[model samples]
Structures are given as structure tokens and as C-alpha cells.
Target: MSTLGWWRLIYAAFAGFLLFHGFSASENAPNYSFMHNATSAPFLSYYDYIVVGGGTAGCPLAATLSHLANVLLLERGGSPYGDPNITKLVNFGASLSDLSPWSPSQRFISTDGVINSRARVLGGGSCLNAGFYTRASPEYIRQAGWDGRLVNQSYEWVEKLVAFEPHLGHWQSAVRNGLLEVGVVPFNGFTFDHINGTKVGGTIFDEQGNRHTAADLLEYANPRGLTVLLYATVQKILFRFRGRRSRPEAYGVIFRDGSGIEHRAYLKYGFKNEIIISAGALGSPQLLMLSGVGPVAHLKAHNIPVVLDQPLVGQGMCDNPMNAVFVPSPIPVEVSLIEVVGITHFGSYIEAASGETFSASVTTTSRNYGMFSPKIGQLSTVPPKQRTPEAIARAVEYLDNLDQAALQGGFILEKIMGPISTGHLELQTRNPDDNPSVTFNYFQHPLDLQRCVQGIQTIGKIVESESFSKFRYDYMSWPGLVNMTEHSPINLLPRHYNSSIPLETFCRDTVMTIWHYHGGCQVSRVVDPDYKVLGVEALRVIDGSTFNYSPGTNPQATVMMLGRYMGVKILRERLGN
Candidate 1:
């Protein structure tokens, strides 16, 4: 074998050993049989409450609700067990690029030309994301009108079981120092609160690099009361109208198992028994529309009979716009995901990750857009996973020449909070598995653009900080390597930009999603303060879909907390406490 081949072989062997040791044993949790595959499980006709989508919100919600009543949790995807791509933190980006029908993430492209993915596993995006965990800001809690004491208790419950204090690696520590050097504010040190300052946040990855997702919260469930069915694709909500002038009521749901078998689950005989849609932002709205609820014209176009002509079913969608600076290191950087964060007063959160490798083969299909990968010029223009063949080749060639050393880098990214810019979601096809057409009109609002500019400038300052100097290259002998000095003082430029493009234009063209998208069943618009769907009965969306704004630095913690919080509230009300 060649000399390069020998080095590659040795490196691979050593890396495998480290990874195996760092990611030991099955996930720690109660040995419960509540989880079952929908394909083989015996059918039940009635459940006190049916929670759809066993994700970040759905898992905790089902677990909490099961304490007092029989709860059936149906997830469209299989359980997130034993899959290295989903369970191991070292393989963070691999699952997102998996284009198989059963992959944990379902890739989609917005009509506005931005690429993104939706979670398909039991744990939802919590299984596919970088695992940063932070509580919602106190201000956010007050704005949402939540009981402060209950919110704190819920967050504590989730943190005890799943969230962990991350052990910062070399790359992460450096990033934190750089953030402080740039005047992000007084260091809050290690804390889960989302205050405006530099702090080391909590992570779902334990010390061994094993991911403890929201699915693990199932251990808290009343084993006899909760039944978890995986690979159960809910087709539509079965609705019935009591009288001609009465409001439509959700009674049951129709779903398909993995083997193409159909089944129906109904609410037990009681006004309190309910059907809850905890499916995510896209899934919840899409499911509602498919079940004959949404704008009348759109439903008519798809030939779905209108159960309710609610015009705002799939409107008011928002995504946090992310812009990043890839800093290629002069030395080896340890692999890490989001650990340290900088909450700025400018309404943007700064975060960093290192040593994440992208699978070139995964990028062959348009459905799988590679994450903040090297060589931006080739990837930014590539169409959706399978949209074009030539583009696929370009995507491949984009990273074909880079060696292992060149891939060793860290990304300093900034994502605007609130993102004032908003868009809407629409059904592309009636199939629930098909991705709904979404348009997150990024930077459409003037204030959003201004925030982007301010965030980008902050990132530039961090890049130029003395602490970050040791990690970056002042000059590179190789062509196309990022010269940190040349791009200083607004280093928002990716590989595609030179000196000609305006910063605002770069913000628009190079715009990407931080994977935080919410709304479409916003509070006071589609659902009431109690999260019950307005103009409907016994139906509620207790997921990110109901949120008007994304919470915290990342929304996973808040979503998980909401699940637990609502579960307690429902149980208390049911028991008349």
C-alpha cells in the first residue's frame, strides 16, 4: 500500500478505538416494555389520550400524562436505539445525511431555496441535533404566560434525566474565550439559564459521548399506562360534527403501520379524553391539513374534504436564520458539537462546533443537504437531493479533493433571535411522508437583515480575538484555504464570496437554517392559551408548532419542558386538584 494509505489506515484504527470507548454501553434508562413497533403490536380501539409524534415534546408529554390515564404515543419513525448515527455524538451529522426512507431525519428544501431537514425518529430533532440544552429565558416564559414555578420544576425534571453539564474540549474552550474577548459580556460560566452573556450550556451528550435524548424521558412514565407505538404514520384525524351549526370535534385518528396495515385509535367515552397532535411544526400543520383542516381553497385543491375551513392552519412559520464563519485550524481540533454559547444583547446567539465530517455520498441526493461543510460554492448551488444529476456531481466534486487534515476545522456561527422575518407552510402533496412546501423568507424583514449584519460583525470580532488566533491560519500554502487575517473585521464571507458582494447580499445568498423553526399553529391564532385548537374541541397541539417564537439558544430544552409541564397541568385538572 502507498504511504498515504498506511497513515489513513492507522488513523482510522485509532479513531475507531477512541470512539468505541467514548461511546460505551446502551443508553441508561429503565427497562420498560411500553415501546413497541406498530407493525407487530396488538391494536387497541381506545385510549384516554393519544399523543402523536414521540419527539422532544411528545415523549415527556406521554410519560407525564400516563401517570393518571392510559396514553397512547404514536411515532411515525422507529425507535432511536442502537443506531450509531443517532445515539453517538461523534457521528452527529451522519444521520441528517441519511436519505433512506427510514432515516431519522427527513430532508426538505424550502421554496425560498434554503435546504433543511425534519426529524423522523421517536426523539425528533433531539436525536438528530447537536444536543445543546438551555432553558427558555425568563422573559420568554413571562411572555408565554406560563406559571413560573411549574416551568422551573419541569425543566429540572428533564435536566435530571437527560441533560448533562458538557465537558468542554480544546476547541470549545477556545471558542468560549474568544467570545468573552469580543465583549459578549461577563462570563456566566456553566449554567443552563439563557441570560445575555458567555456561558457553557448543558448538553444531552453524557461523558461517554452517548446521546440521552427526550426518548429517554420515557423511563419516568407509568409503565402500565403508556403504550409507545413506533413506525406508526398517522394519516389523518377522524373528526365528527355533533350538529350542523356546532364546531367540528376530533374523536380519533387513522394511521398506517410500517407494513402498510391501517389502524384506528379513538378517545374513550368522556369529554376529558382527548387527541393531541405533538407532531412538529411542519408535521402538526401538515397532518391537520391532510385531515380536512386548513385554508379552504388549499384543502379543496388537494381534494381533502374540509372538516373546518380554518384559514390560519398552516400560516405564520418562522425559522432562525444562521450565518457562519468556518475557521480552518492550523492544528488538529477535537471533535465537538454545541457546548459553549454567547447570548448577545443584539438578539442573536453565538455558538461553535468542531471536527464534524460530512459524507460526500449523502450529498449525492438533493434530499440530503450537507451541513456547514467545506467548499461552500459547490454546495450552495446544488439543487435538492435528487432534483438534478449534474448538480449532484458538482456537490461531490466540491469536497472530492480535500484530505482529512483539511476537514479539521471549527465553525463560529451566529443565529438571529425572534428573526422578525416570517413565512408560511403549504402542502406540496397530500402524502404525510412527503415534505410540505415551506418558505422561510429569510431576511425579508428590514430588522431581521439588520440583526444579521450585527451578528455577523460580532462573529468577525470573535474571529479576530487574541484567544482564537492560535486556532486559525494567518497564511496557507495550499490554494483555497481560508486566510483568517485577510477576512478579518466582518469575516462573514464563506468560500463563495470575494470582496465584491455586499454583506447584505451575502447574508441573503448564503443564508442557512439553524434548524429552529416554529409556528403554523401559533398561540391565539390557531390555538388558545390552553393550547386547545380554537373553534374545535378535544384537540390540542402541544409541540413546537404552537410556539410563536423559538425558545432559548436552542429549543430542545424548552420543548421537552413543555411536554412535562402540560402533562402535569392536564393530570392536575383531570384529578380536579
Candidate 2:
């Protein structure tokens, strides 16, 4: 046989081996059986530690704790390993827009009328979000009072598994240059540390477009000591009080499985045996309130038994408001997630992604669509009398054109990193299955509006720069339905940028969440510096909800870092590690 023929035969065998191994690995994920489907199984009597909401923080924290103690990690959603919609980078939007009850993302519309979703999967937001990865700013670490050395070490632990250096495509490269041109200065190159500059950073998506989430951290778990139950919705924390003046202690969790059969899992008898609530910002507070740990009046109104009247349990919720400019490229650009970021001095951040088309479902929620028609009354110029049938028909036609343009997709995102405005979360119903009422209260503060305006202006500058000229795009306006080919940055601004009302209107109409919600269970107010609930014993809220303030970047890295740090701290305190 010829050498070439022999090489082909070898290649074929190698491909076959890979195909078989890939199928087997997924079918029997090394620790797959360790993950119990709560519907079919009998609950264990107890564990040394029970971590609620097996998400970004919970997965790692549970894994680490299992190194020394028997740990139970309960998740409301299924594993993300086998889902193509989650593993593929291009399907990032599809994962978030999926409204199915079993979908990893639970979609909700805020009181302010912005559509958003929170992660319902074991990996949590890491499974649903854009794959950008950056370490928390040093200032954030200092403010959180985290051990700096431990925090740095934790970054390494997460990065070893989920982090990757993105292979920037043409459009992403252009974006980097454009950010530099706009004075987001000092090219810091590839580094995970959050620095103020135009620089390439880590990503959760690899060169092959596969995503690695925090769930992968389970590889570090001592499988013998860890039990992960999926499709188990924690209804409330089971609390006990020893004396009249003693603080309520969380001893067990009441959760309903996929079969809707309720079960209880308790902690072993010891002071170190704890229940950690690693549910994200929304879920943590909702769980706390349901468990009767919120404001006294609010709990009483719902007829819930008050365990602790911690007023701050559901307060201080904040999310980064995002705005974007969709530039339709004349040429095809390689698909990419966030590669280069522009850390601006104005308390905002700029990041860009290149892909074939924007998610169709996302376009359906934009202002161009009729989803926001009810809120049109809030607009200053759109009078009530203007709600004519003819006007509606014209608006629909304009939206159709805008959707078509969006499908052509060159996407860039401008996010307000730090906003002063805060919101809150509250239970709409006592049921664990029901989503809580989330109010971002975006643009409620004067500074938030100004910051969003600055972000928009920065986006305009980047797109107008020489770096983006190769794309050759047209501007699409909201109300006026104006399309300009000359690319006038002035046209992008509102008619009255200096005026508070007009700017606020523009912001309200355009602003949407980047889904970096944090701070419901705040550090000093809800949970202490050690991450334990302020008024409770043996219970800690260890997710983004415990963030003292929003970090100045995508928060997955920070959440994972904190998870490891907390895990290590617990180990040292309890096991003398």
C-alpha cells in the first residue's frame, strides 16, 4: 500500500476512536452517576454540609468541601454537559432566550419592563452567559476584604479548567484597535487581571468554540464524599432554635424533586456542619425570604413564619445596564465571543463579539418590536393621540427592516460597569417554582443615566473610528426610523443629551441587562465578611448575592474565585487544613 493510503487509514482509525470516546465520556461522565436525579432517588438522611443551588459558586464550594466532609450539592436544573445549545459559543443567545420550564435559563421581565433571564442550571450563569472571563478588579477584592493571596490562588484553580485564550478574528481585532483609538489606553495584552486598558483577556470558550463552565470544577471533587442532585428545587431552609434568645440555625433543607415529591436533607450534628446558599442574587434572596429570613412585615404579610427579620436579605440588588450598536458588515467575519475588552476610565466597559447573526429571539424583545409598545406612553414625544392604526402599521414595517439588519450581525456591547442605582428582589409567591419579582430600577438615578450616556457615546466613537471603517455600516435609530450611511456620531446622541429627562428616556428605552446581577445578600448587611448570614447560624450565602459591590467586569471569574476562597477558609477553620 502507498504511504498516503496508510496515513489515511491511520487517520480514519483515530477519528473513530475519538468519536467512540466522546460518546462514552458524555454518556458516562466520570462522575455522572454521582449526580442523582432527585425524582427517582431516596434522600440521604444527612450530610456534613448542604450547599443549595449548585451553580457557579456552589459547584466549586461543594467540591472543595467534599475533600474533607460529606457534601450535598442540590441544583434546580439539569447538567449542562450534553446540551449543544450550551456547549456551542454561537448558541449563547439561544440558551438565554429558551423559555421552556426545564431550560437552564429562567426568563423574566423586570418591573421596569426590561426582559432578562437568570441561570437555572447546575453551572448557573456560567452555562448561559457570553464566555468572557476576567478577574475581579483589585479594588473589588480589597472592598470585599477577601484574603488577597487566597483570591489570586483561587483564580488559578478556576482558570486551569474553564479559562482559555480566545483566538481573535478580524472583527474582534478591529474592535481592539478601535478601543485603543478612543483612549481606553495601555495595551495590557493577554492577562486575566482586570486592568484599565484595551487588552485581550481569558474566555471560557476555547478555539474550537466549546465552552467550559464552573461545573467542570467538579473534576476536583473527591467523588466518594460528594453527592450532586439535579432537578431538586430547594423550597426553604429548615431552621431550629435552641432557646428563646438563640439565633435560628439552618439544620436541613426542604426541597422538591423533579417528581414534585418533597424531601429533606439535614446537616450532621456539629457546629461546623453548615448549609450554604450559593443560589445567585435573585434565587438567594428569594430562598431566604421563603425560609422566613427577610423583613418582618413582608414575611408576615405572606403568612410565612419569620425566622429572622433581616431587612437587607432582599435589598440592594444591582445589574449592569447594557447598550449596543449592531454594525452590519459588508463582509463575513469569523464567529467569536468576547476577546478584547476596553476598560474605560468613566466607570463603564466596552467589549465586542463577532458572529453571523444576532439571536432572533433577542431582536423580538428590542424596542423595534412591539414588546415595548405598552411602555411607549412613558416616552416624552410619543403622545397618546399618536396610537393610530396607520402609525402602528408603519412601526411594524420599520421593525421588520431592523430585524433583517440585525440578522446580518456585527455586534458590539457597551456595558455600564458601576452604577449607583440599586434595586431589590421579593417573592411573588411562596412556591419555589415561581420566579421572584425582580426590579433593576435602571436609570432611576441621575448618575446611572449619565454613565449609560457615556457608554453609548464611547460605542459611537469606536464604531466611527478608522478601525471600524472596513465594516462600512449604517446607523439604525429607534423612534425616528432614521438610517444614515455617512455615520454621523452626532445622530446617535439624543436631541437633548444635557437634559436629564431626554437622556433618561433614551436610557430607559434602550438599556437592557447584561445579566451580571449581584448584591441581594450584601456583605455587611445580609451576609458577613466570612459569607455567613448575619442573623443565622450554620448558613452562608456564597454566590454573587454576597457581592458587596458589583465588580468592574464579567463576574463569573470573581464568583468562582470567591467559591474557592470560601471553601478553603471553611476547610482551614473546620479541618485545620
Candidate 3:
């Protein structure tokens, strides 16, 4: 079949990835009658399971565990229900720009000089991410020693309520074709299965452009068994030295509410009852270190009482390095998140997004805050609405200098798959809400750098494809005057990389994070295969921090599934199934 004709057939068959016929607007908010303010609630005592950090993995884990066990979920941030910036697709990237204490997204910069964000809301990163949903490759499932049947069932359990097929538009379609044109081969079309091909994956967003986060999966929970406390930050995991021969046991967590009033929640007296840390990559590790479960010397330096003295707690950190080529479009393009992807044979993946609202500001969540700065000078932590004059002037000047054409364009990005270069996290302070000091050491490994070079070249091929010409900007012409028929070749950002700079150097200098970071409390190192923290009883790390390698194009799907899968496994073990 002819290429164009074949693509038409593929599109017709897939219907542009809005593939599932599911429920409508009502699914956006699930009535959580059991949810309460950490401060307003009466003092709580114990739960069958105490799940810390009500995030992507934490939500599903808590919800599933609540089927038969009483679960207490503590989240440091507010709810995502009324946050339009998080729920609406048109306002997708806006949440990350908000630096206020109440913002759903908390921006963090790695000591490696890469800017990143952590989810502060109940839904976690899902509330701040591009909302793409794709399962881990089958190889990933096998390597993790996951029960295939249960794994598939767990993915479906989450998907049935949350995941949806995405609607493909002109830009996404062009990207789909461009991926095939560049020999990323085999038009697998619309699928949630992770495979080596160009395909449209699932999204958490439904047809109405409203995101369905892991928080929505709480609808499956038994409300009577689940108590979710919003705006509660867990200060530390309280441990007991049972005897000289026994390891320290995690019995409960000490958390502070929004009013800064301390509260204690403990685990029920049962062998199966546990305290699970579902904090993201950063949070999980930081929580562990703060609770005196990390490296002994480091914890001692911080004057924290040693609990486990586990050296691997904050080690093996990694973040996928992302680079992009912004293709300026002549006409108005539809705004979209990550809807289509090209999974290549090599250790890399290609994805694209159009019409993202780009903003510049210094995210002040870390001591290394100036690293991610776009030279806007110093800004106050008071947020934009109440910014000082000097800060306001700096932001205004930066915005005024932005090229109008750049805002009208789309970005075709490539991120190195499963970056081999690893770094470590250290506690900057004992404060639970403070950002942890981390370094991803992007492209530190020669193989990772080579993969990045290959990925960028693949993107270059996509840019040079005939399919992308329809949207390529006419660089020769002035801004807003680009003629669609006569366009210039799209290139990487000049300030980032060019013909003069070597690709390896470009990979190092322009490296940014796709936020697929994992490890720290890695499996086989800190946690067992069952995700239980080694040397510590009744305590586990169930989030992205436990991952050795990030699964699929986005780790969110696997992370969510892990929550459900592990919860089910724990329940079965309780039943002796």
C-alpha cells in the first residue's frame, strides 16, 4: 500500500486514539466524603496502613489497600478538584509556572543544573504532567518479576476508570507521520502497550480535555476504610528499637497540618499492617533520610537520630535528559500535550507537543535555585502576584525579549531512554517540605551521551521529513509572516546547540529533565522485590523511587499500576491466597 494511503487506513482504524468509549464529565470528580483537612479533623490514632504522600502511586495504593484495610493518606498539598490550571488541557503547563505555596506543582532544580517539578497536590505529578499514559514494555514486566496476569489486571483496573484514548489533531498527526518517515518504523497505531514503533498512547485526559488523575481512582476505594488528609506533611517515620537483635520497626508517622500543628498517626497492631511511603522520587528518598533510614554518616551530620543506617536509601538517582527542536508554525496550531510517541529500537524515545504557553521565572524551591534561572535575576518567594519591583522588572524585561514566533511554534523533543548516568540525593535541611539536594549527572555515562546524540539525529530526520514541512516555520521571513508553502528548515535552539558545537557537548550543556527520574530507594538495594524496605519491618517504599529503570515512555502509568498491583498482592497475602 502507498504510504499516504496506508496512514489514512491506520487513522481510520484507530480513530485518532480517542479509542475507548467511556463515561463523560462526571468522572472528573469523585465524591470523597472521607477526605478532610489535617487541621480541622479530630485527632486520629491508627490505620491498618499509613500511606504517606498522597501522590500518583500513593493514591491508587491507598485506594486499593482501603478495599479491606483502613488507610490513612497524608498529602502535603491541596486538592486538585478546583484547580483549573491542572484539570484543563488548555492550561496544561500553567500549573508548573505557579510558585505560590498553594500551587499544585512544586518546581525543583537538580544540582546538575537541570530544572524539574514535583507534584504538590493530591494527584501528584499526574496533576502537573502532560497526561500521557502508556504501559511498561513486556520486558520491563518480566524483569521486575511481576505476575503477568496480575500486572495486566492492575493496569486495566486503573485504566477502566482513568485512562482514555487521546484525540489526534494536525500537529500530532504530522508528528506520527514524521516518526514513520524517519524510520522509527512499524505504525503500531493506537495502543497502550509499550512497543518499538510509532503509536498513539492512552491519556489521563478524556474527550472534554479534563484530566483524570490517579486521585480519581479513589472512587474505587471503600470510603469508610480510607481517610485522606490534605495539606499534611509527614515530618518523620517514628521507629522503635524492639530489641538489640531486631531492626528498627516503622510504627507510625509524625506529620504537621497546614496550621503547623503536629499530629501523629500510627499503624494498627498487625504483622501485615504497614507504613508505606508513596512520595515521588525526591520525596521518598528525602523522607527516608529525614527519618534516619539513609546513610549513617550523612544522617549524623544532620544531627538526625539514626534508625536503620541503610546506605542505599538515597543513592542511584537518575533522570531522563530531554532536548528539543522548536518548529515555528506559520498558522495557529492546536494546543496539545503528549498524545503520540515514537519508541525507537535504541535507548531513546521521541515525542512532541504544540502550542505550549512558555513562561520564564526563577523557581525558588531549592538552594540551587539559580541553576534553572533564565537570567531573570533574583525573585522573591512571595509569588508573582506580590512580587517586588525589581523582580517584576526583571520578569517583564525577560518576557519582552521573547521572540513572538517561538510562542507560536511547537517542540519536537527527544529524551534519552533509561539514562545510565546516576546520581544521589542528600538532605539540605531537616525540613520535610524543603527541596532535597539532588544531582542527576545527565550524560555522565558515554553510552547515555551516545544515545542522546542518536536521539537528536532522529529528531533532525523528523524535522527534515516532508510530513513536517506543513508546519515548519519560514525562518527567512519576519515573525507572523511565515508562508506555509515556503518554509525554512527547523533547527535546534541556537543558544542551546548548533553546527559549531559538538553534539556531545550540546547533550551536556542543553540537558534538561523529562522528569522520568527514578531510583534512590531502588529494588534489590533498599527495597526487596515485594517493595518492602530491607532491614525494616512493616515499612515499604512504593513509588518511583523504588524503580531501577523508568518504565515505558512515561513512568506514571507503571507507577500507578504498581500501586494497584502491590495493594492487590498485599491483600492476597493477608488472605493467604
Better of 1 and 2 by TM-score: 1
TM-score-sorted candidate list, best first: 1, 3, 2
Mind giving the per-residue lDDT tens digits that candidate 1 earns over 1-577?
A: 5463354335334433433344334645335577766755566579999999999999999999998999999998766765677777766667766665666888877787666789998889899888899999999999999999999999999999889999888888989999899899889999999889999999999999888899989989999999998778899998998898989889999887766668999999985888999999999999999999899999999999998889998888999988876777778888788899999988888898887454333333222222464222113322223324355455455445445565567778888998787889999898887899998888889988887877777777776689888787764453345432342211233432235766677677557777899999999999998899988989999999998889999999999999999999998888894
Candidate 3, residues 411-514: lDDT per residue as tens digits? 77788788888999999999987899988888788999998888888887776689988787544653543432122222343333456777777666656666
- Model 1's alpha-carbon lDDT is 0.79
- Candidate 2 lDDT over 1-577, as tens digits, reads 4463354335334433443344432343444446766664465569999999888999889889989999999998777776666776755566654555666778776676665678888799898777889998888888778789999999899999999998777889899989899898999999898999888989998777777888988989998899888778899999999999999999999887765667899999986899999989888999999999999998998999999899988888887887655566666676676788998888778887665433333313443211122222111123223434454445445444543433343556677876678888888999877789978777678877787778777877887799888764544423223553222111133434466656556566657567787888988899888988998899999999877566757889988878888999999999762
Show model 1 residue runs off by greater than 4 Å.
1-30, 42-44, 356-371, 374-378, 381-393, 475-499
Please identify which of the two predictions, 1 or 2, would achieve the higher lDDT against the true structure.
Answer: 1
User: lDDT score, residue 347, model 1?
Assistant: 83
lDDT score at residue 532, model 2, on the 0-100 scale: 86
- How good is model 2 by TM-score? 0.85
**TM-score, model 3 to reference:** 0.86
Could you report the Cα RMSD, in angstroms, for every candidate shown? 7.6, 9.6, 11.1
